[model samples]
Target: MPAVSSPQPSATSQPHHRFIKISRYIYVFREFSKFSIWTPHVSFLQSLRRLAPIPSPSFFQTLDIVAENPDKFRIVGLAAGSNVTLLAEQVKTFKPQLVAVRDESLVNELKEALADMERKPEIIPGEQGVIEVARHPDAVSIVTGIVGCAGLKPTVAAIEEGKDIALANKETLIAGGPFVLPLAHKHKVKILPADSEHSAIFQCIQGLSEGALRRIILTASGGAFRDWPVDKLKEVKVADALKHPNWNMGKKITVDSATLFNKGLEVIEAHYLFGAEYDDIEIVIHPQSIIHSMVETQDSSVLAQLGWPDMRLPILYTMSWPERIYCSELTWPRLDLCKLGSLTFKAPDNVKYPSMSLAYAAGRAGGTMTGVLSAANEKAVELFINEKISYLDIFKVVELTCEKHQEELVATPSLEEIIHYDLWARDYASGLERTSGLSAVPA
Candidate 1:
C-alpha cells in the first residue's frame, strides 16, 4: 500500500500523540475482520482483540475465495506510477483477477513488476491466460485510482460490473459523481473511500443523520512553497516542490502537495462523497497534517479524524466496512519517540496560490470544469516531472484549462466524451504561455 504520509512534520515533536494509539487498534481489527467476513460487524469487533501481528493467513484466504469467484469480485487497477507494484501485490495476496488498461508498454512493465508475485503465490492463468473465479458468489469489489480521467474508464467498467468500489481516485467521483453515484445507488452498490482525507470524512459521517452534517474541513500540508513568496514561485525547481516536509509520496503528488491541487480535488470529492453543496466544505492548511479531515455537526462541534497521515491505514478500514477493524497500518507507534509537534491550522493564502480558488470555482461551476482542471493539472504535473515546466506553471496550466472550460455543460458525458475532454485539456495546457516555453522543464 502507498503510505499516506503528511507533508509537513510536527513543529514540536511530542513523545506521544493520540492518533498513534487509535491507528494501531484500528489496524488489528481490519486484518482479523476479513475472515469473520459473513458478518462484517462481527469481523470488525473480533479484530479488536488481537494486538500483535495481524491475521494474514485466514484474512487473505477469505479474500482469495472471493478472487476465485468471478461473480463475487471483478478487480481493476488504474494507471499510476510507483504504486503499481503495490496494486500488483494486493491482487496477488488477495488472489483477485486483475484488469489494467494503459499504453501497452506500461502494461508490459506492470506484468514485469508483478512477475515476482507469479513465482511466489503463483496465480498462473490457464494456458489461455485466464484466471477463473470460484462459485458461491463472492462479495467482491473493484479498485480505482483516478487522478482525473486517466482512470475513469476502468472505474466505470468496474462499477458497471456491479463491483462496489474502493475509490482512490477523487477525480472520478468529483467530475462524474452526479452520474456515477446515482448509478451505484441504482445498483445498490457502495463506493468505499480509499483516500485518507475522504475516508476520514466518511468515517466521521457514519451513524449520523445526513441532515446533521453542517460542513467538512479538508486539511492540507501547504506543499513546498506554503510560505515562499509568490513572486519567487515561478522559479521553484522540481527538487524544491518534491521536497515535501511531512509526506513521503510519489514525486508527482509531492509536487501537487506544493500546489494544493490534491486538497482542491478533495474539496470537490467531499462535495460528492457527502452530497454537501459546494460551499459546505472548507479547506484548512494544517502544516502538521495530523488531522486528515473534520466534520462539523448541526450543533457546531467539529469532529475530526486524526491519524499518522498514513494511507494504508484508511484503505484497510474500507476493505471491511461498517466496522472499525485492523490491518498492517497499525503496527507503528507512529513515532518511536517524541517526534510529532503541535498541530497547526491556517487559512490558505489565495493570492499566493490561486489554484485553491480555481478548484473551488471549478467545483462550483459544476460541469466539466472539475474534469478539465484535473486533466490539465495531470499534464502540468507531467510536464513538471519531465522538467518541461516549473512548479508555478502547474497551477497556471490548470487554471488556464479550467478557465477555458468553465462554461462547459454540467451533464455527465459518455465515457468517450470524458476521455475526449481529458485529452483536450492536456493539449491546451501544453500551449500555455510559460516563459520557459518548452525551453525549461522544472529541473
Candidate 2:
C-alpha cells in the first residue's frame, strides 16, 4: 500500500508537538490533499478541525483538539502497511495513552520518536500487540487498518474484548464473515465500515428496516482495464493494470480493481455487513465515480450517497459515528457537484472482468471457499506484481485453487478451519509453476 507521509513538526516547533507540522496550513492542506488524491486539502482541513482537541503547554497545543474531548479515542491499534504509518501520525495528535504496531522494528521507531514527549504512550509489539491495544484500560474502539486476511484474528480478538471496530480491512469480513459476525453479536460490539462504499450503504440504510431494501448498487470505476476489450486482457501488463482512474491505492487492491476482484470482495462484504443475499447485491460501471454507492428500496426508490471520491469523509464518520463532527471541509471541491456536469451508469461486463463472476461463485459456495478464493487471489496478485505471472493468469490461479480445494470446502468452518483453508490455498497457489498441470493462460 502507498503510505502517506508522517505529519512533521514545523521548523520552530518542538519535536514533540502534537499539532501537524506545517509552515503554512493552507499549503500543507492543499499539497497533502492533492497528493492523497482521495481526500482534498479543503476537506482535510475541515476534518482536522473536527477532531477532539488535546490540551498542551506548547504554542501549538491549542490546536490539539483530540485531547480535550472525553469521547475521543485514547488507544489505537494499527497494522498492515504505509497507511498504518500515516494513521499512526494522526493518532499521536490525540496523545493516545497506548498504541500497537505489528513488529518490534516499528516499536523501536515509535520509542525513538516518542521519547521526547512529556508522556509517551505505551507501545506494544507484534500481532499480539493488536489485541493488547484493544484491551487497554481506556481503549474504546479498535481501528483495524491492516490489509489482507492477516486482520481477521486480531479483529476477532478485539471484538471478544468488547471493543467497537472501525474496520478498514475488507478481507477480514470477506473471508471470515461467517465466524466474525456471530462473534460480534455475542460480544455486543459494533462493526463499523471504514471503506467508502460500505459506509455509504450503511448511512443510507440507517433508519430503515433490512427488509425495506431491495438491492445494493455498488459503483465501479471499471478499473485500469475498464476501457479495454475482453480479448485484450490477455495482453495486460502490470504497468497497465496499476493505472487506476480514480483512486490511488495499494498495488494489490489496484490490481484487484482492474480484475473487478475488489468489487467481488466488496459484494461478499456487503452481504455480511448488511445481511443482503448474492442476488440482491449488484455492481454497476459508474466511470464518473461521483456517487460512492446506492441502495434501492422495496418501493422502487434509490437513495444514493454522492460526494467527491474523498476517503477521509468515510474514515472520519467511522471514527465518530452516530455523531457528525464539525470540520472546515464544508467548502471542499469534493462536496461541490455543479462543476461535475454529468453522471452515468452501465451494466458491468463480467466477460471482461472474470474475477467478478468468480467472487459471486465463491460467496455462494459459502464456507471455507471464500477464504480459499481470497488467499488464491492474494498470491496470484503478488506473483503478477513480481513478474512471475501474466495479468490474466491472476484469475486462472484463483480458479484452479478453488477447483482443487472443492472437497476441502466446509459448510460452516470453525475459525481454526478457516485459517487452515486460507493457508492451504496460499500453498496451493504458490506451488503452481509454469510446468504445473494447470494452464498458464487465462480462462
Candidate 3:
C-alpha cells in the first residue's frame, strides 16, 4: 500500500496583504464561455478601464471573484504563455505589479502590447520569471494552473515562500508529491485544491477526527466513450476523445478524461491530499457529476459534497477558504435535486481503462514512477491528438515508458531527479511511436 498520513497544519499566521499570484500555461476562451454565470459582465470590464492587469478570460472567474471585494483581494502577479494579446488585455485590467511570459520571445510582444498603458508593470520571461511570480512577497496565495512538470518548480518555490497554494495543476502533486509534500510540511504552507473532486474530498474531511477516514470515493463523469463498446475503441478519432460530455477543459485534460487518466491521476492526488491509501481510494462512474466526491468514515457514515458540474464553486472555495463567499442565487444557481431527478453510479470497467492499473501501480512504486506515468501520458495524448498514433497506443506508450523507467526508479528523488525523469519519460514516450510499431491514425 502507498503511504498515508493525515493533513498537516497550515502556517500559523495569515499574511496581512491579500494578494493573489496566478501562474498558467495556456488560456482557452471557449472553455471560459462554459461557465456562463462566472463570466464578467461587460460593464465590469468597462469599469476596469481606469485600473489595470486582469487575467485571460479563462481565469476571468478567478479575477471576478477577486474583483468582487477589491479592498480585500488584489491581483499582484501573473505568469502566462503564448496568449500574449489576451494576457496583455488582462494585465491592463487587473494591474498586477509584475508579469511573466513563457519565454524571452514573448516578453517583447507582451511589452509592446502594454506600451499604451499609463502604469507599466515590471515584466520578466522564462522559467525564472515564473518562479519570481510564485514567490512574490505580496502574494499570500499562489494559484498553480500551469500544466505538466513545468508547474513543479514554481509550486515548490511558492511553498518555500510560505504562500498558500491554490492547486489547479495536477502535476504539482501527481508528479512531485514526494518532493513537494515534505517541502510544504517544512514551510507550514496550506495547499488548497482548486479542482472539483479533490475540493469535494477536502471539504468533507474538514472536521473529521484523526484516523476517522476509511475510504475516498472520487466521482467520474465517464468521458466521451463511456457507453461505447470496448471493441469500438480502436476507431476512436481525435475529435471523439476531445468531446468531453461534462467538462469544458483543455485538449490534454479532455483526452485525459476520455481515457479515465484524469481520475487515475486524481486517485494518486487524493492519496497525497487526504492521506488515503491506494486501496482506500476508489473511482465510480457517476454519469451525472453532481456529487463531486465522498468520504466514508470509520463508522461507515459517508459524507459528500454536491454541486452542479461547474468549476466556479471549487475555484471560489480555493480563493475564499475557511470562509465561504456569498454568491447571488440568480448568478450562482442553487443545486435543485428535484430538477436533477436522480444521480447514478457504477463501477469503472478495468478493461476499458488500463490507465487505472498503471496509475495505481506507479503510485504504489512511489517516487519517480508516477512522474513518468504522467509525462508519458501527456506525450502520448499529444501524439494521439496529432494523429501520429492510434488512441489505444496512449496506454501502450505510458505503460512501456513506465516499464523502461523501473530500473532507474528512485524512491526518494530530489527536485533535480524528478525533473530529469519527467523529461526522460516524455522523450522515451515520443520515441515509442516509431519503435513500438503502433499504427498511426489516418489524418
Candidate 4:
C-alpha cells in the first residue's frame, strides 16, 4: 500500500502577505493573475468577525485585516451596493482600482459617499462591472463570495482569466459545477474551498494519493432548529430560523442552516470538489462544530480538521495554501479540547429536513438539476423570509420546481444554459407561491 504523504512546510524563505480583497458574493479574490475583484458585504464581513474573541468590533473588521498589512496585500477591485457607507469606508481605506455596485442608480450614491476620498476608483454599475472585476488583469485569485447564481458568471470570467478561485459560494459548485469544473480544468485554475466544512475536507485530503479516499463525513451544527421536533418546524418563524446556535451569519445562510439546506448544498459541493459519489458522502450532526469535517481512507482511517467555529482559518488557508500562516495566539485563539467536555454526533433526521434528499437526488440527476435545486431553494428562502410563503412551503417550492424542471434538465449544460435555468428556476419557484397555494404562516 502507498504511504500517505504528510503536509510539507512553505517553500518560501520569508512569509509574504498576498494582496487579498473582499467581494460581496460568497467568495474573496486576491493577487496572482492580472486583475481580481473582491466585494465582501456587511453580512459576509459580520460572519467572518462573529466568531472572533473580540466583542462586536467595527463592521469593517474583516477588511481591516487586509488594510493592516499594506505591503502583503492590495485592494484591487470591489463590488458592493447594500451599504453605501460601509462600501465608502472600504474604498477610502483600501483604495481599490475598480468598484462595482448593484446597479447604475447606486453608482452616484457610491460616488457621493467617496467624495471626501482623495483617490476615487472608477465605479462600474451592474453585472458587467462585476464581471470586469472578476477578470481584472492583476488578480491572481478571485473569491466567489457573491450569493446564488449571480456569482457564476463572474467566477467563470475569473477562471477564464486564469485566476485561482477561493470559493465561498456553494452555488458555484452546486449550480455551475458541470460547466465551471471543466472550465477550471481547461484553464488550469484552482478551485479552493473557503467554507469550513469543505475546507476541512480539502485540508484532510491534501497529501492523500488519488483513489485513496473512501468516504466523506460532513459535520453539521444542526442549525437553530436541530433540537425541535419535526412537527414543530411548521411553526418556525424567520426570526426563529435566524437564531443560529453556533455561527452568526447572513440571513440567507442562517435560514439555510435551520433548514439544513446549507448542509445539503455542501454535500453537492463535496461531490464536485472531491469527486465523491453522493452515496459515499454522509452527513452527521455534530452539535459542537469543533470538527469541521472528516474523510475516510480505504483503510478506514479517519482524518479530520478540528477548529473553533470561526471561518477565518478556512478563509486564511485558501489564500495561504501550500504555506500555513503564523497567526498570533491572541487574535486567533487556539482550540482547547480539554475545556470542552465532550463532542457529540448523531444522524440527521431526514423527515425533518427534506433538503438532503432533494439535493442528493438533484446531484444524481446531474446537469442542470443541481442548479435548479439551488435557485429554487434561494427563491423559496426569500419568500419565507418575506412572509410570502410558509416555512413548510420552502421545501414544497423547491421540490415542485425541481419536479417541473425534469423535462428540461440538461445533462451537460453550457454556461448560457446554466444561467438561463438559474433564472428560470427562481422564476418558477416564485410563481409557485401563487399557483401552488402556498400561504404565509402567521408570525
lDDT of 1 at 319: 59
TM-score of each: 0.72, 0.79, 0.86, 0.87
RMSD of each: 10.1, 13.7, 9.5, 9.5
The sequence of per-residue lDDT tens digits that candidate 1 reaches over residues 1-443 is 11112222232342211110111001112222111121110011011122112111122332343343333233321222334455465556444432332323445656776776644322323211111111112323444543456445545554555545566667677666656777677665557666788778878876666377766788888988887988887787777888998877777678778888888888777767666665566778899878888977767678888777655556555655655543333353353224665778887777766666777777777656677777788888988877886676677677767777755654666656666777888898877745554446433
User: Candidate 3 residues 1-443, lDDT tens each?
Assistant: 22223211112232212211111211111101001011111101112111122222246666665566565445667677667877788788778787877667978888889999999988888878777877776654566766788778777877888766667768988889889988887787667677889878878877666677767788999899999999999989999999989887779888999999999999888877776767677888899989999977766678999998877787676555565667779767898889889889887888888888888888889899999999999999999999999999998899889988998999999999999999999999999999757978745
Give the C-alpha miss distance for residue 95 in model 4, angstroms: 1.1
Give the TM-score (vs. native) of candidate 2.
Answer: 0.79
After superposition, the stretches of candidate 3 with alpha carbons farther than 4 Å from their true spots are 1-58
Total backbone clashes of candidate 3, pairs 3 or more residues apart or in separate chains: 11
lDDT winner:
4
Error of 3 at 147 (Å): 0.4
Local distance difference test scores for all models: 0.57, 0.64, 0.74, 0.74
Worst lDDT run of 10 residues, candidate 1, spans 38-47
Candidate 2 least-lDDT 10 residues: 33-42
lDDT of 2 by residue, 1-443 (tens): 11112111122232221211111100101111000001110001112222332221111221233334335423232232223445355445656555666655666666666666786766666767655654554444455555566667766776777656656667678778778878877877767676778878877876675367766788899999888888887777788988999987768888988988889889888877777767677788899888889987877678998877665567656555566656554433436566778898887776787787788888878888888889999999998888787887887888888988887789887889888888999988988746354434232
Those runs of model 2 whose alpha carbons end farther than 4 Å from true positions after fitting are: 1-94, 105-115, 436-443
Best by TM-score: 4
